[model samples]
Target: MTNSAANDDGELSLRWSGRVSLTPRILAVNIFALALLAGGFFYLDSYRSRIVDSRVAQASSEARLIAEALRSVEPDRRDALMLRLAGDTGARLRLYDETGKLLADTRALGLRNMVLRDPDKQGRGQAAARFLDAMIDTVVGAARPPLYRERADGFAWPDVRTARSGNLIAATVWRAPDRTPVITAAAAVAGQGVVMTTANATDITQTVRVERFRLSVVLLIVSLVSILLSLFLARTIVRPLRRLARAAVRVRLGRAREVVVPRLPSRRDEIGMLARALSDMSLGLRARIDATEAFAADVTHEMKNPLASLRSAVESLSMVKDPDLQTRLLGIVRDDVHRLDRLITDISEASRLDAQLSRAKFEPVDVGTMIAGLLAQREARGVERGIRLRYDHREGERMTVMAEGARLERVFENLVDNAVSFSPDGGVISISATREQEMLRIRVEDEGPGVPEEAREQVFSRFQSLRPEAEEFGKHSGLGLAIARTIVEGHQGDISVESREDRVRGARFVVRLPLADRQ
Candidate 1:
């Protein structure tokens, strides 16, 4: 999946921007709707165009057929042919010569036995006499743009001249004066000149208006549905976000208050992950705040003990005059000073231990090799004390782990040094490491008094030292065990102590670290 600004790992400040939104107004104000509207208009116009074209084409074909029939008549009796043709066709028929001379006009009836033009349209459709004749003529000749001429009329339309040139021409005009569409078709005859016919179209404007209204209604309904769907989508997107936003606001305003973050665990989207992150951050911040406060209090309490001792030593020295007493009091002062120094040093290192571990890069290091090196250093000091630091493992064997080798060695040093202080003179400290299951367990066993069952865990606490009776006071900081525990836990390991299983009286400090798995 692609990462987004909305992802959980993104900064909370960016996620809380006022301008960011889950609104889907983009869909409601649609571009596709505009496209569909334009398409509908174009479709209607195209349909209108097709209707007009078909009417014109039909008119042209019928005109050509009439012209062919007219060619069967003699030129002088072409007037009779035109009249006969007019009786059969439902159109306004007219005949014109190549020179634009009117040959016959079917607008009126013939004279009493003489065939002629009738401008009054009184004798129309009179052949084979009946009451239906006048009705047929009136309906057929309803549109007469030619008869209502301005007398200076020019038939300059391309179809007229085109027909006169011996070719058939069909033309349609929309919205003629009589409120009807008109189609005109003209064709040239072989000997009887050109025949022209005109027809008023059946009412299609009303039909088109009805269809346009229905289409508009359909489009309106579709647009409304689209808007409602977009609204639902917007609600779906914004509901969870609204809850999260409210929780964040509460948490921000009331910094110390516990805010319950909205958790949508079913949703595997960015929003759900962000909710989880916020919850974790809240809990972590509270915990760190509490821990730092406790640490500070503990540090102050530890430092006060040495300061009180130093003050006592100085006061006692000023009151004493004997050299032996003076020297002893001075030693006390010196020891207290050294104790303060050790406390400060250990405290400084312990305080920064977390940050140091965070920043330090880990590399592959053999735990066995590290323990061997540490023992070698301690062995020299042990030799002077008539004690021995021995490795129980086989030579050259290794247990590898991913760690900052220096820090890991410091962990071993603390345990071994503690063992040294508590061991009797000439005591042997046995150190060995072995892989157990998926973990590496290292034990440092010393011939010293084993920790009591009651204080076993507390021995790892700050300033909880249980030193050997023979060791000099204030020579070592009590922070050693605490610091070692901190470092081991930072490496996701555990450190604990118990009586040595192989011996009845000795103490065994066991350090269990996770082993690095190889691919």
Candidate 2:
């Protein structure tokens, strides 16, 4: 890549890196928020698990009670015992023989009695009995032991005989169950395979729903709180930076002597530390600029006297010498004297402004009135070299500003004189003023050879000139525009030159000054 492109890339990289480095503060806030959410999840998980375990324990107790009641019934009278138990417990009851054969059922007996008493009740009851039988069979076949226990618990099944479908079958004998094993009452019942029970999940589901709603509400509140806190944090972090940026821009435009960093939060954070450091740096920079300006002023002042004496001596020598040699020597001496004078003047003015030598006493001045007065004064000099001058006040009464009258007049005098000097005989110089938002813009346009494009940016640099043609012709010092710029900028304003080509086809200098605030 070209050097300029590479330099631009390097600058961009530095800016991006600087931005990335500032993200740690934002990241810290996010991490804190994440920690809060994680803690909430952990608390909810534990709470839900406890609720589930409590429900499971309650279901296990109920299952054990029913199993023990079944064990208390004798084999032959089990049908009547189950009927009484079902009425007391409000549950369906089924009894099976030792051989797993269908015997007598309480629901079936109810249907048979209904047939003897009422025919319609008998049909309805019988249908209901069949449905209940099928449901019990399905449930019993599906049941499995909730947990396994070792023989160390001291229980075993006894062998017995039974009959099923006209065939003999073996039956396992079981001992009486203990109440403690059944209802927090420990008891060993043999030959009774296994029993299972389940609790209603509706309450658990409701609890879960409530917990989720509460969690969502908590998270919403946390999110809202986090947003408000983040906004406050971002403002606190960025306000000082924005202030610094504005101050830097003002300094670059030569409108301020030093940047004043505002006080930050009392906490000793990185942002606070950076503000302090930047304040120190600005102070140091202002001091260095002052020192440089003082040195330049001293040098310029010291050189002026010697230069004036040398020029006087050269003029005195020229008057006594032979015509041909004297003319050539005189021209060389005069040119050298003019160059020295221009250099001294530019250096002096630049140093004075940099040092902020003094403030011009302010007064209410009408810009149009002042321009007219100056033009009349210049015309009285009787040096009209065929250049037509015109003054136009388009803004009328709006062009007035608060300024130092004499200083303001001197600024216009320099501009007008410079335009007159550059204009060819019969060329025109126009002065105009227009009102812009919060400012007054004054322009001086001359139809002469204009400044070169390449040299426009550096035209206000001290002693720098784009006047090669003038230098060859041995006429015109180049400090006029530079001095004008300094005076204009001193008023918290800007001055710039606009030109077309090397030859001064037309040159216009625009000055913008802030309008006086009335309220």
Candidate 3:
């Protein structure tokens, strides 16, 4: 018993072991898609970073400019300047005394809050003096001033502080009457306490938002276009491969005598190069097949004449020998003749099928009628062998298909003969026909010991057969199923075997052919 073929996993396993699968192509497409996605994300990230940096720089520079403007105001005009600056910029202004007490607040002064003063006078004075000395040293190549002073801290001081002669002075600055909050900028004044200005950050933030929105829209459009183009490219690359895959399958099934792939214009690119390579490979394969067929035909023709002469000589020897010896010699001759006949027949059929396939005529024939006729013919042969033949047409009458009638009939005869040969005496052989969508199916089943699970597939290969258990039951030529499969495929159909147990209990051979629409 041999193991039968099984595809219970719902995966398409390639039968031709030498060919590579398309998994790598699929992986490459996915990889390219991921690259596109990553590129889009990277572009957006870089754009957002630039927008953030620009916003931050603008904010910092605006703060510095406001602080500088406030520092140049005169002490007498400081109050007026603060009011004007606060009103113009929509910001708050505050002055503190050296003691960390609030000295003045633009908004609070209106509410009579004792002109806010600072309490940390000594700390502010020391910090101011140090900063001034650093600035002088940087500008003049020498420290030109030291300003620090600790005072009884009731005086109002500006929010900005500066150094003068080892003292940090404190002074009252103007206040503004405004309800809107603002971003404040401060600078230390040299002799005066501090100068501060305020400006609205709202406009800057709004501008940033507008710029971000515009950039986002542009980025989104570009990303979308990029994705679409990537999809187009993926499809472009995959389409030719898909066609090549189908052509490969046809070649594997022995359906195609020659494969002619269409030229690709896009072959100037990498995918185009791949397509050209595949086309070249297909042409080479066709040429090799042609050469092999010619070789087989020449060899078979050369051997046939010698084989015929050998058989004739053996027959002559049998006629001149003793009865018992003659019988033995005749048996040997018969075996040789049968062997030669089978060899020549298989080689001839293989070569002819290979040659005629490219030009075989195809037309519509009723599948149900064809099966009925085959069953009728088989029934006549079965009756002589004490076997009963049964047939069932499950599909309604006149299931039509587009195929060559003679080739299809040969396929049918081969399957029926295979079933009949395996069927036991008093056993039944059944024929069935059905249609499903675009295909017509025919099945022949024999009640015998079913083929083993493993042997079912090998049974369809040339010269492959089960080993004979009893010495008397000679092994079959084994090319019947292979030839039948070839014929069925030439008609654009498929043939496969189904069996249950390891023993030859029963075997069902199924044939599927494309249905043709009736006018």
Candidate 4:
């Protein structure tokens, strides 16, 4: 409520209300990315299995083709032919006779194991592939499966048994004794023996492993970006809200230190609206508190005057000997008591104004009808001071507005009674209503001394009196105008004093209220 805080509020603010925390917001945003990463991990596991199965199929087909080549060659020269086949398939080829005895071995050539160990070692293109494999295993902890050794001790293996039955079986891919991927296949060569192929499936496994490693790197990068974004959100949105909350607490506690309310109008979000609402509410509370305190002080001061006069009269009555003087003194005591009663009554009404207005249920009121009805009652009572009450508006017309009808009637009655007291003898109090755009304009003009420009506003303050010279003091309570102003404003209208348009000696009070949409 200080001038300093008021001035602080008027300055332009570049800050907005969206100071949100990035932590929670970032987590919310990354939800989709996390789901995608989960799906990728699942896909990788399935893809690794598929790769092994595909390599097994390929190895089986290679074994069948090599078996056909052995059948055409002479049995004695088959070993030299087997050496040529081993170089192509990168597998150790073995020939087994019908009795399950090993007839010839492809490793006699010494080139088969070298080819299987590092098939792509001779090519520079695969060097990067090997390095990536090592890196993926290091970072992701992709443990190698145990190696497998094929039993060839004159016993029929699954592949050899199935192949001799002409089934051309391909075994599942497994790990070799050297930690390389392994698969087996067999095919029978007519009048020769069964050709068994043992293949290292390291290429397929490495391919899947490298791809999964790339995906993991991508996921790590995305997680890092999401965290940074969350931090940014926290700074932009949440920080300002916390500042507002602290400012509100200071204002509520009536801190002696001035707290500057934030004026972050730049934001288009709900935070901007909240800041503005809180600022307005705080200012309103401060004004109400100041007004209530001032009103209470004024009430105490006003009440003291009557109490002092009555006390003086009572003390004087006991000492007076003259009967006539004693009667006059008693009357003075009665008059003081009456004044106190009237003052207290008006004070009570003024205090109840806010709560009564808040609890009042509003309805559409015909301003023309309300004023017309009030004017009739005042005229029927007959102004003892020879003041004539007149109501003027368009014939057969009405102007309505949303208001608490009974309370609004009280507003005009107070204004009229005040005007009657202030008017000269044989004076006419003119009340008129007219529609102006979307507003209803009403005026009460009195044939009395027009208010001075400086004193007009002060007249509506509690305990402020500007009564006529002829009017008896006790009959008028200065609170009438103040109460009238409060009631008018509570109805969302303004009441102001002005010089009457057609006369120089009379004062005019104009009221403008928003017109109701329906009759």
Candidate 5:
């Protein structure tokens, strides 16, 4: 089940690894939104229809006024009146008898106020206007009106026929040659003649074109601004992220030592925080790698000495036949084997200590009480080589720290054991716990040859021991101080060794831990 799940995850990762990134996706989202807004803007078909309806209504009103005047005026003066009204209204007026026969026409009588324009004779501007008109029609799905044409027989117009059939007024809208609206209206003339008015409504097209032009300009400007802002966002965000990603890739590809992660110290945002974190992580990983390499080399060198001694002792056992010599060789072999075993055990503990400490949960421990307990345990077991154990602290003072109890005890145990190894017979091993400001300071001092100032730092390093000459070989591994330091640091505390403060011939190991908050 796990293998199948892993395979599926690997496939998904390969599918979408590098196909699209942040910049293009951001631009696409912004442009898609703008396009939706543009769709709403360019839909002007309904507006044009409203304008055409208004023009037809206006034309019908003018026709009704002319019809009433023709009925009220003298028959001999009707042509002059029709021509004058046509000129005033900017439309052609035609009079027809009840039988659909044309009686009098405004244009025939000499008024030519309006004319239909030929699209072929117009300039490039008009052509572009027509192109835009067609585009708008297609986009908005406008239904085209029938084309307008003149007829000598007045009955050919539906509105004229309706007027002749006793209707008070009727109107129709048609498209002119240049795709502009042509509005016509007819009205009954005193129940005898029919009066028709026709206007080339070019102003409708110009008004729509003007409105479309303004909206187009607005859309263009908005689109430009949106694209520019998207690019700026990409630069501010994606560019830095890309640089960080590339640096991480370099680190992953074994170029960690050469790659310098950007900290972006100038930025005070989340990106800056992430950059600093990643940079610190990379530096810490590099330091860990170096420490591991040095540790491995030290372990190899330490193990070789014991193994070489064991092999020599084993070889000498076979070469000598005398019982006494053989007995000495067997003892040497045992000592070397014990040394090797002790070295391996300490090495394993040292290597796994960091991982264990990282996962440990800490609790408040009283430094004075814990040391007193340790001292009591030592007294129960009897001090080694008659060395004395002493613990001192303020009787009522609380010296508490947050730490893993067992690991913390191990640190003090190593310190006391180290002091015992160095102390002379019947010497004192003094342990003290005291509260110092925010820290719980514990010190273990021994009356022995003091550590040199130059060697104090090296003594805490793994496999770097300063054992007393009188101590038996293979009795102590040098990892005690190193392991104690590791546990101290893991608890957010520190441990160091120095000469005793009172000019005494002994080493003082001081451990400081931040005091836990008061409950």
Candidate 6:
């Protein structure tokens, strides 16, 4: 059950993935990764917070220093000191009583150090900055600080209340009406009231926005490059594969002769390998189909001869009155029947030979031993008219090859039988096996007519015959050498016939197979 479910899940994933073509999938994955990187860059939110914290610390220190100065100064001199400190620090300085009553301000002292502006009263640029700040904050999920506002009671300020009650400095950061940070700090004077400092840190927002803008530019450039590379990759891989697929479909639809599968010869990648392999496969399949058609036509031609002979003999038997002629006609009828049977049997074997050899398991076959054994059997059954078979090989030498033993034996059997059919009665049919470099060579020589140079190759084709003039018609099916050649080639070997090298007036059939690895 678990395996089945896993298989189902795997198939479902394949189906889902197949819905989206390769180019889009590649683009989507790259864009998603870029989005993640952009999200990480947006961490400028924490960067802004750190900048505000630093400003708050500076404000707190300034408040403490101003409170100490106010404590030592006389009442009238304190206002001038506050005004000077506010002008130098670029912060508004204020003094409040312990009872939360407002006392003195930097503006009241004619310093006019800092002013908090309302965003609604600013220009379009400020509005755009505020909008960008909100977007950045939302993207990074930054904490939202309360808006900065003035209160009638100074003690109502959180930092101010804390400073007065605890007799210690307290700082707080607030968002201004323009979305910039406002840092405020309050310090309690020992013998006096509270000292407060406020500053607007606009540089923090500017810094974060600049970083985000730079990141956006980088992301845009990378996305464009990634998309182009994806398209290039898809063109190199997907286009060739699609061409191969369309060719295959055409081939499957019986248009193989017309389809030309592309062979990407210039590329050295796996896709190139696939294209070449498909091209080769299509060529091989097309050849096989053509051969099958030709073979069917040949089979029809071969069978029709015997069938027509049989039909004529049967029809003539009824019209003839003489016993001798009737007996001759009956003999002709029998011959035709036997000939047809033999032809059918040979045709079936030839048709199935390739398929069988493909599935055949091979073992080490000693060519010398196999040939000797075959000759021994033929000799035991005595050749007609004192005909003799001769075997030649080194007694103790190994001539092993990798092959299906039975099929290899059949190849030799056919060769020997073919030689016997051409050899004169009482003549020696020479058989020899020898090692030739990395191959095992066997030759069957007959003392009779030799095959013509031009007809040598044709003799191995299906239903081709080059029989002796003395041999009766239909004595041989003519598929022996053809089947033998097929079997030999299946074992990674070759077969050919030529005039005997010894200057004899006969033909020599040579079979060469790769020698088996001894180690």
* TM-score of each candidate structure, all chains considered together: 0.69, 0.41, 0.42, 0.84, 0.88, 0.93
Put down candidate 6 lDDT per residue, 33-119, tens digits, no spaces.
Answer: 888877756677787778788888888898999889889999979888888888888998878998888799887778765777777
For candidate 2, write residues 94-189 as lDDT tens digits.
334444333444456562211112224447644553343334335445222122121211112111112222222222111111100111112122
Show the lowest summed lDDT stretch of 10 residues, model 5: 9-18
223-324, model 1: which lDDT tens digit per residue?
887777777777766887788788788777866346777677887878779878877776776677677777788889888888988999898888999999
Residue-level error in angstroms, candidate 5, position 455: 3.7
**Residue-wise lDDT of candidate 5 within 50-110, one digit each (tens)?**
8888888899899899899999999899888888898899999888998889999888888
Ranking by TM-score, best first? 6, 5, 4, 1, 3, 2
lDDT of 3 by residue, 1-519 (tens): 223345433365556532643445445555566656444433433443465445444434543454455567665776666566556545555544334354455665452212222324436644553344344335544322122222333232222433122233222222212111123334444434443333433333244345545655766676677666666765777677788778778777775565566558656887677778777777878877786776565555655654775677686784675787777667766766766676677667865885587677778788678778877776665464687877887556788888778878888887777776777768788877877777888878888666777887888766566643432332355567877988888877888888734344788888888878733
Worst 10 residues of 6 by lDDT: 9-18
Error of 6 at 128 (Å): 4.8
Compute the lDDT of residue 85 as modeled in candidate 4: 86
RMSD of 3: 18.3
The per-prediction tally of clashing pairs is 1, 12, 43, 18, 0, 0
Candidate number that wins on TM-score, 4 or 5? 5
Best by lDDT: 5
Which wins on lDDT, candidate 5 or candidate 6?
A: 5
Following a full C-alpha superposition, what root-mean-square deviation does model 5 have from the true structure? 3.7
Q: Can you tell me which runs of candidate 6 are displaced by over 4 Å?
A: 1-15, 117-129
- On TM-score, the candidate that comes out on top is 6
What's the C-alpha lDDT at position 439 in model 4? 86
For each candidate in turn, give its C-alpha RMSD to the true structure in angstroms: 10.7, 18.7, 18.3, 7.4, 3.7, 3.1
Off by over 4 Å in 2: 1-324, 327-346, 354-358, 394-398, 468-477, 499-504, 517-519
